[model samples]
Target chain A: MKRSNRLVVLTDFFLENPRKHIQLPYFVTICETTKSSISEDLDIINEVFQNQGMGYLQRSTGAGGGVKYIPAFSRENSMQFIEELRKKLEDPARILPGGYLYMSDLLGDPRTVREIGRVFASAFSKVKIDVIVTVATKGIPLAYAVASFLNVPVVIARRDPKVTEGSSVSINYVSGSSRKIQTMVLPKRSLEEGANVCIIDDFMKAGGTITGMINLLAEFDARVQAIGVLAEADDEEEERVINNYTSLVKITNVDIRHNKIEIQSGNYVENHTDS
Target chain B: MKRSNRLVVLTDFFLENPRKHIQLPYFVTICETTKSSISEDLDIINEVFQNQGMGYLQRSTGAGGGVKYIPAFSRENSMQFIEELRKKLEDPARILPGGYLYMSDLLGDPRTVREIGRVFASAFSKVKIDVIVTVATKGIPLAYAVASFLNVPVVIARRDPKVTEGSSVSINYVSGSSRKIQTMVLPKRSLEEGANVCIIDDFMKAGGTITGMINLLAEFDARVQAIGVLAEADDEEEERVINNYTSLVKITNVDIRHNKIEIQSGNYVENHTDS
Candidate 1:
């Protein structure tokens, strides 16, 4: 195949199997090119990826070392998307009967969900997350999006008991906002023992659901490596149940009567230690 | 820039915006390529896409008739993956209480979900689906996956009523397997009037949920263009509520007492009218 054709083929392959290491020899065989030529093609791929902020390739040297394509949106790209999302969230028409904001439109948008996934994946890029965990219903799509980027499996916590899941571990916790006792369940085989799990959700108010998830993770011997939310509802008086979490947007204030909403950049917008 | 490098950028962009038409001038500004050269690059993309069964370019002639990339996986590829999935479904361990299958793990896996999306996208590629719709919870990820490939937004019908979604139209539907009444709601503004929609779900028994969706869609003046399910249960006595649907796998038999599950390729496995 010509170089142009080979480039397209290679890029497609890498994209299909993101975060997987492809050895140099494997590439030479598939592209029908020498090691030197394959390496040059990779250089162009890496350069274009970096220049366009599409993603990056992690390179290793010597024996057994190979490159892996890690899908990531650049800081600028993430910020730009988040800002637009923030503006969308600020609309008065989004305010509900209470302080809640109607974000179903944003959640349903493929571009918004994918970009949100990219932002979270970029934020947690340095972390080792074996699985992405979230509750059923609203958070499932968001979890899947992030899992696709991180190249990991997602384990969802279910609110309703499912006979298909077989025996499951169920727990009851107080809803921080409503103070109602709610139950969440997970199948025994859904998650691996000692896996590093990332907890994600669509919205966080008083952080009760994630708190329940943290407690639930204890049963699997899994540790919470990271926590990310699309939006966090800020409550000045009541303290959040957990910390060390990142949110894309923070709802600073919401007035139902006046149909007013206050929004700002989230903690995830700040630079964090890279591994 | 070289033609080889430009292919990388252009292909990446097209993939990101799948099924969306891009005018020729848009490529000229983005890739900094002359009109003639851009046309040549598209020809290469179209050839590779067709030859490899990757996808096809829908071309329009002259002004306002730029080509659009419609993502698809060849029939062979789709069959290979679906057969594997059928085998996975046949595992005795997947047999749950009351003949339910343990498939949360499969739903969570990114590669599995993406391939499932590809199969559905290929099956429904001919249809004009303005939006993808599904009930909340298990179906959200699958819906999002199909929507991603179709390059359309997903509109989830919430099982739980939330105050956030302003005014909503709610409908009660019977669960196919359980025969229990369930309520689902969708925001009034979420979908456009008279839009064409694709209904998707993870599993179906008598197809009550999607049938309810089909009914609810009428309230919004929308129409169900297509229906796809990952798996459908074969009940000997009962007839399915909805017809003319595609399924990747069929659960032919599920005996909880004997811990046996028989799986077969679904209606979608056959070659249909390829528009």
Candidate 2:
């Protein structure tokens, strides 16, 4: 193939497999090009990826060391996406009967979901995420989005058990906001033992649902390496059920009858951004 | 940006917005390039995409005509994915109590889901799909995957009513296999009225669930442009509740006691491949 053809193929591959390391020889074999030529092509690709702020390439000289594509967003860029999302989330029309915020519209949008996925992926870029864990049914899409960008699988815990999944492990936990006990179950084969898991959800009220996922991960001996949510409702106690978690939007207030809602950027803006 | 940079940017944009038409001048402004230069670049990109079978570019000359990226998989490639997936799915270990296939693992897999999404997108490339719809829990990921490729939002139907979503429209449909009436609900604001919707699901037993979705779309004055499923349970009648649809795999047999299962590629193989 010609150099342009190789560049196009390589670009497609790298973008699809973000955060994956592609060995040098593998590229030479696939592109039917010499090692030196492949190396030169990568340099050009890397420059474009970096200049575009899409991702970055890491190089190391040693065994088990090759080109790794790390998708990233500058702190400024990350904040921009979160702020724009926060603005949309603060609309009073999204207020539900309870303290909940209706986020189905936002969650259902592919463009919005893709941006959120990229933002979360950038935030958790440093962590090792083998699989993404979420609870059914609303969190499934958000978790899937994050997992896709991270190039990992998603394991969803269901509140209602179905016989179609064979045997399962169940766990009961307290709801963060409702203060009600809820049962969530995961299929036996849903996750691998000792896997590094990342928990993602569409909304967090009391932090209880995410905590349930954390406890559920323990059944498989998997570790919760990171926790992220699209929105998190604030409480008077000022401490969530699960600590060390990041949320993109912080819901400060929701007045149902008055049709009022208030929101601000979450910890992600302060933590994930450069300036 | 230079021509090389323009090429890279254009490739990424087209890949992300599959099935969406982009006018020539839009690229001219975005890439800071002449119309002739942008057209030349698209030709090169089109060649690589066609050769790799990832997608193809369509060109029209008259007014209201523009370039469109159609994601597709050649018949040989579509069969390869389905056959390989069928082999794994046919394992007795994946058998559930009532002849159901345990597909959560496959559904959660990003790579596998991407291929399934590509096949479905390719199959429905010519249709007018304004939105993708699916019933919640298991089908959310599959729906999200397809929506991403099609560059459309996903509207998921809920089995249980949640107060957070405000007003909703509910529908009752008998499941094709269970022969039991089940209720599925969608928020009123989930979809635009009269939109062209493509319904997708994880698995279809009696074709009842998809039928429910098609009925539900009627409440929104929406048109069912297409229907797709990851797997279809073969029935004795050789016809499902919904006559118009596509499935990636056909489950021929499942015997739990004997630990035997059988599968084959679905109708998509004959319909989607570019022979």
Candidate 3:
């Protein structure tokens, strides 16, 4: 294959298989080129990727060394996306009854969801995540999206037990907003013992659901490496139960009667800057 | 930008934005090259994509003309993937107590789910789909995976109504397997009127859940363009409620006593061959 053809093929491979390490000899064979030429191709691809603020290729040398694409969104890009998301959430039309903000549309959009996933993945890029754990229904998409970029599997916890999942471990926790008790279940076989887990969700209010997930993970002896939410409600009335998490946007206020909403960039931006 | 650099950026763009159309001028400006150079670059990328059985770029002329990447899987590649999936399903240990297959692992794997999504997206490559619809839980990931390839949004139907979604349309239908009535809800704002939809699910048995989704879509005046399931049960004891659907694999038999399971390629392969 020519250099041009190799570049296309190599770029596609890297994008599709992020964080997947492949030996230089493998690429050389596929590209029908020498190892030195393949190394040069990697350099060009890496340079372009970094210049575009996408990510860079991590290369290792020696007997067990190769290259893998580390997908990290630049700080500028992440903040830009978050600003756009905050504006979208600030729309007064999103105000629902009972002071709720309607955000299903944003979560339903593949592009938007993937972008959010990219931001969260970038936020936790340094964490060693063995698997992404999320509750079923809304958070599943975000979990899978982040998992795709991280090259990891996702295990979803469900509210109701299903016969198909075999034996499961169930935990009951208090709902943050409603103050009602709810049950969360995860199949015993879904996760391995001591697996590092990253929890993802669409929204967080008082952090009860996330706390519940943490308690559920305890049953399997899984370690909670990170927690991420697309949006978090900043209501002072309700005591926040969990801390030390990353959020893309914060809903400081939602006045249903006045038909107004307020949103701001979440802790992710501040944390990113501090780091 | 040079042709080598252009290939990397263009390939990444096409892969990320699968079905988005961009005018030739737009590419020329981004690549810092003339229209002729951009055209040559597209041709080279398209040729490599087609030769690898990945997909081809669709181009048009005139003022409203542009290029879009239509992702498709070749029959050979699709069959090869399905064969691997079938073998994986045939594992006796996947059998649960009630003869249900424990496929959450496969569904949880991003690569496997994405490949399954690619196969389904290619299967319905000709259909005019506006959005992909799925019921909450297991199907959400598959729906998003397919929507990512199809470049459409996803609307999820849930069993319970949430206050955050605002008003919703609810429908009651008899679940084919249980022969019990169940309610499915979709936020009224999630979908527009007369929208074309593709239904995706993780599994089908007696087609009850899918049938319920079809009935639910009717409430929104949505058109069901296609239905794709990762797996379908071929139990002779239970009558199948749906026929006009595509399945990747059919679970013909699951003998709990003998710890045996039989899986075969679904109608997708046969339909593709016939076409």
Candidate 4:
């Protein structure tokens, strides 16, 4: 294959298989080129990736060493996306009857959801994650999106357990906004013992759901490496149960009668800018 | 930017934004090159993509003329993947007590799910799809995966409606295996009227759930362009509710006492091979 062809194919491979390491010889064989030429191709790809604020290729030396693509959204890009999301959320039509904002459309959008996933994945890029855990229904898409970029599997926690899943571990916790007790269950075999986990959800109210997930992870002896939500409600009346998490947007206020909604950029930008 | 860098960037863009049309002038501006050079670059990328069985670029001429990337998996690649999946599903360990198979792990794995999505998307590449619809819980990931490759949005149908989603249209249908009445709901605003939709799900037993989804789409006056499932049960006893659809694998047999399971490649290959 020619250099131009090799560059296109290699770039597609890296984007599709992020965080995966491959030996140099494999690329050389596929490209029908020498190791030195392949190395030069990697250099050019890495330079373009970094220059475009996409990410850089991390290369290691030695017998067992190779190259891995570390996907990261630049700080500028992350903030800009968050800001755009915040503005989109501020639309009056999003306000529901009970001061709830309708965000299912955004979550359902593949491009938007993938972009949100990219932001969260970029935010927690430094953290090691074995698998992504999320609750059923709404959180499933966001979880899978982040898992795709992180190159990990996703284990979903459901409100009801099915016979097909075999045995499971269930936990009951108070719903943050509803203040009603609900059950969350995960299949026993779904996660391995002592695995590192990253929790992802579509929305966060007072963090009770996330806390329940944390407690659920305890049963398997898994460590909570990180937690991320697409949006978080800024409720002054209710006490926040969970801290140390990343959110892309914060819902400040919602007035149903006036059809008004207020949204702002979440703490992801602030935390990531410093790093 | 140089030709090598342009190749990498263009490849990444096409892969990330499949099915999106881009004009030659846009590429020229981004690559800092002449239109002729950008045209040559696109031809190189398209040739490499087609040669690798990834996909090819479709170009048009005239006022609205542009290039669009149609991501596809060749029949050879699709059949190979389905065969591998069939063999994987034949494991006795995957059998549960009630002759059910445990497939959450496969559904949770991003790579596997994405590949499955690619097969389905490629199968329906000729069909025009405005949106992909799926029921809540298990099907969300597959729906999102397919939607990602098709460059379309996803709308989920849930068993129960949430306050944040506003008013919804609900339908009661009989379960295929359980033979019990159940409700399925989709938000009224989630989908537009007269949309070209593709339905996706993780598994199908007697196709009751899919039938319910099809009926529900009728209420919105939307057209069901295509349907795809990861797996389907080849039950001799029950009558299948759906006849027109694509599946990647078929669960042929299961014996709980013997801890044995049997699977085979689905009809996707036969239908696609002739085309």
Candidate 5:
């Protein structure tokens, strides 16, 4: 294979199988190269990244060890990237029933999830975001991705309170989709009073959950520094409650029955300049 | 400061604040250098990592864009690193009250958590692990870390079933630390029948949760290809129920009262030949 093709194959392997604990023989097998050749490829790839002023590749020298990436990339750049991503999301296929916008795939992809987190982290680099608040399930990974980058704790605001969560403060907010009341809660002490809070969610249609999160933060006497959403549906009817929040992507409409999707950039990533 | 020192400070910032979206100006501010100087440092550092086959450093050319590390380090190396980590745990200080091991710090650390995930992902590179399994809270991140690397979904086994999860498959097992009967459950269809499985946790004391996961996998007729842990306390008890696991660090013992901690190489890492 040509050198470029070989590099592509290596990158494909790296992205597909993200193990840093395999033995050298295994990598040699995967790359269909000798141990020494694999090492040389690694060296070249590592060199390419290092020369770029990005994060370095790490190697474990012991049993079942191999290589891993320590990204040295800028989070600020990620925010700008999100702006581009937001523009792409202008398609209309993401809207769901009940004013909900689907964003599971975005949260599931490591690259995209990391980008979203990086953008938020960059946006709040100078500010204090003591906690990341999101409703359960779809929002968990986004919360995790952001929390992971921020090195702070993430408090999941569940629609249904669990006894396991101990004592929690809850708020009844209108569900944007159904216009029905839904309750969201957080541990009473999850955030401190006057804490600077950043709220995140996977999608926003009516922003009910986001509003609930805003209320929960207020219950703790916390201030909302910013709110971020992966995608926001841009239908005029859905805007009944959205105010002063940022969305990375905007979906104009979706036809699940017809399998159509539309999305674009939301105002947040577009308006927010790189720091 | 010298270039090397400057790089260290910059790298440390990335490590310290994983949550912040990074930018050139931020680097310039921290290093007290010109944006151009910081850019040069970033290039040098990025080059070093790339040359070493460590990982890739990605750069975007725009006013708002800068550099960030997109780790593509090998999974094989991560698995080997975990083996080394396991060797470290054979020591005694890791043991804590009720035969538990303290590892909140490692679990909470972005670098360590990411590395730990890479370790398991490396181990299960060839295996088709449909779902990464773990108990609630602390294990959630580990499960996420491994899943992030493998590009697989993670399923958290709740100690008790809640309405949020809908229908779940419940199981009874002994606690790894307490060795008492406990119930854990997974949402129905969380693990497909006959799906390949890789179990992960923060610490393995009695291996009870691991055992429980094994049972839960069996309930779904899922195959548990291998098990991995962040740390394993060397229990005085005879015969561990599970085996073929990997860990990053080993706690031989811990004197929490005196605030003393001990760690060393784990067997998982030591067994590698470094090829």
Candidate 6:
């Protein structure tokens, strides 16, 4: 293959498998190329990934180690990817009765998940994220993937504490659906005081849990470096309780009768750029 | 290095970092040996993996392909790994006054988590597991890693319907705490009707949720081939609720007053086994 195409392939591999730790023997075997040849290819790809300021390819020495793509892409890429995703998400087929949208396929899609992880990773590229926090259930995967990329641990706040967790700090927040007091908890030492934390959730509705998480972070004197959600329901009448956060895509409107959903995004796109 | 030691080191490499697809360059880099030497090592290792009825390693042709380990270990191995895990859970120091075992460190331990995944992967090796189902949120990572090994997909069953998950199929059941109604959901079509599914969770309490899942699986006519939990609390009462199941560890008892927890595992030290 031509050198340019090879570089494209290499970069594409990194982009497709975001937050994945991979090694070189697999690469050489797959590529069926000499080590010198593969090394040359990686050298060029690494320079491009670094020069572009999007992400860099990192090589780990010794056994059980290989090349890992350290994604440094910015929020702009997030917006770009989401904009494209929004179009698909807006398809009438995705719209269901009761104003709900179908997103299981997207959530399960590895490629899409990778794209989502990269977006969050890019947004927090410069911030020293001590931990990624998310309320139980949906947000765990997103939190886990992004934390893995950032090489930080993930702390899951449970809707109901387990005896196994023992002596957890609890918070009561209203569920997005019932507006009833739902309790959540985290281990006492899960997050250090003054720790720089990033809060993420699969979806944002009224942002109530996000607020609770922020409060929890504050209780520990932890700073909220950034907040991100995979999708934000964009109904204005829902009544917002908090502000200043980044969402990969914003739902501008949803028409259950017509099976249509509209979305654009915030300036987090234009304001955020990767080289 | 001695041949036996070399095998151990190489096996560790394969276990530590697994991939669906790989390349030769990655292996050469990992082993830090000549291409031929590494190839020979892989030949032996591949045979070892295959002979043990574990996953097979397939080498792909072309410039970007390499060897891929198709996970095919048995559910029997999962039973064994979890048995050892139960030993850790039984440590009295892990108990709380409230009769709960402390598993935060076990949950946080990556090495343990990886091993859990490999053993879990052994189960359902034959089934085409399209989606791994688990009630959130601790089950999230176990589901993710197991899915990665199986090279399939995973879906988290939320305690309740979220704004993002459209039109969820909700099932009400008792949670671990035995408190109020705990609702979980599997989005419609997330698991195709009649699809063979494998369920995994971090812990089993009353087994209410597991039974609820079995009920939900009935709704879709999906088959639940096996159920695996990281730990099975061994209280005589709880033990009655669990049968025909496998666990990493069995928590015999928790003496919260003495901060003593007793554990026994059936995983690592199985009788009459040779690699």
By lDDT, the best candidate is 3
lDDT of 2 at A73: 67
* Alpha-carbon runs more than 4 Å astray in model 3: none
Model 5 C-alpha RMSD vs. true structure (Å) is: 13.6
| Candidate 3: tens digits of C-alpha lDDT, residues A181-227 | 99999999999999999999998998989999999999999999999
- lDDT by residue (tens digit), candidate 2, A34-153: 988888788887888777677777787689768977878667677878889988988877877666788888888887887888888888988988999988888787787788778899
Question: Which one is best on DockQ?
Answer: 4
DockQ rank, highest first?
4, 3, 1, 2, 6, 5
Q: Stretches of candidate 5 above 4 Å error?
A: A1-102, A148-153, A158-175, A178-190, A234-242, B1-112, B118-138, B148-197, B201-223, B230-275
Q: Is candidate 2 or candidate 4 better by DockQ?
A: 4
lDDT of each: 0.86, 0.84, 0.92, 0.91, 0.63, 0.68
Interface RMSD of 3: 0.6
List, residue by residue over A164-268, the lDDT tens digit for candidate 1.
Answer: 788999999887778899999999989889999999999888888899999999999999999999899876767998888999898998887777898998887
The weakest ten consecutive residues by lDDT in model 2 chain A span A266-275
Instruction: Tell me the lDDT of candidate 6.
Output: 0.68
lDDT of 1 by residue, B1-275 (tens): 67878888877877778898888998898888798999999888888777667787888987688989988888877888999999998999887666678898898898899889888998999899999999877888888889999988999898887776778999999887778999989889799999999999999888889888988899899988899999998766679888889999998988888889899999986755333
Off by over 4 Å in 2: A63-65, A237-239, A256-258, A273-275, B60-66, B236-239, B273-275
lDDT of 4 by residue, B240-269 (tens): 989999998888889888788988888797
Q: Candidate 5 residues A1-275, lDDT tens each? A: 33333454454344333223346687666556778877766676666545544434578786667786544345355555765675554444544454344343344455567667766665565566776777775666677677665666666677766443346788999877667888887766455678877788877787777887887778888888878887777646766476887777677666666666666667765656644
DockQ of each: 0.79, 0.71, 0.93, 0.94, 0.06, 0.19
Q: Any residue pairs clashing in model 1, and if so which?
A: none
Report how closely model 4 matches the true complex, as a DockQ value.
0.94
The DockQ-based CAPRI class assigned to model 3 is high
Worst 10 residues of 3 chain A by lDDT: A266-275
Per residue, candidate 6 scores C-alpha lDDT tens digits across A1-275 of 33433343355456545456887777676566666676777776666555445577778778887787777764456656878887888887777656777777777654466567667877787777877888877677777667655766778888777665667788788766457887878887577878888898877878888888887777788899888888887545578776878777777788877667787675457546662
Poorest stretch of ten by lDDT in candidate 6 chain A: A1-10
Candidate 1 vs candidate 2: which has greater lDDT?
A: 1
